[model samples]
Target: RQHSAQTRWVVLNLTGEAKSWTLPEASGATAVLLTTESTPPTINGNALPLRPNEGVILAI
Candidate 1:
């Protein structure tokens, strides 16, 4: 997966198999939909910090 963050947008990009469901969008640098119990945002295969004004980028 991959993502690019902005002031009010967080793009969740998938580099793996497609899922039956799609993730939602984030606004104002806040991502709530990506923070689930089953699937969470990670960095280098490890969990990254969810900060206030920064983005957590993931690569696959």
Candidate 2:
């Protein structure tokens, strides 16, 4: 638990009009990291697998 940070999220500020971004085509990046955490997530809970879809951003 020492090096672990219970981050609710990692974020960047957005200052622009509404538009959809296609990563590789728009930004010319092969991949993007969502967080600084080196270890990837795995299934460990007693629940169904997640269904991927549009990401949600919330204002704190």
Candidate 3:
């Protein structure tokens, strides 16, 4: 979803195993605002790793 100043992306790992996702290109910087997992949020380059049944909210 998009708002006046930022875009929000919701990513989920529905499978039982971990998964990696390449975030969509954004006009500005991106940050992980919220996550289901306890670990600190980190994105490797543009790739995000999600544990099983995890979800995240990204802002750009």
Candidate 2 regions exceeding 4 Å error are: 1-24, 36-60
Best by TM-score: 3
The TM-score values for the models, in the order shown, are 0.22, 0.19, 0.29
lDDT of each: 0.38, 0.28, 0.46
Q: Backbone collision count in every prediction? A: 0, 0, 0
Best by lDDT: 3
lDDT of 2 by residue, 4-52 (tens): 4433443422123212222333443333332211122221222212223
Q: After superposition, how far is residue 10 of candidate 2 from its true place, in Å?
A: 13
Could you give me the TM-score of model 1 versus the true structure? 0.22
After superposition, the stretches of candidate 1 with alpha carbons farther than 4 Å from their true spots are: 1-10, 13-46
Report how far off residue 37 is in candidate 1 (Å). Answer: 17
Compared with the true structure, what per-residue lDDT tens digits does model 3 show for residues 1-60? 857755544444334223334445662445544343523234544444655336666654
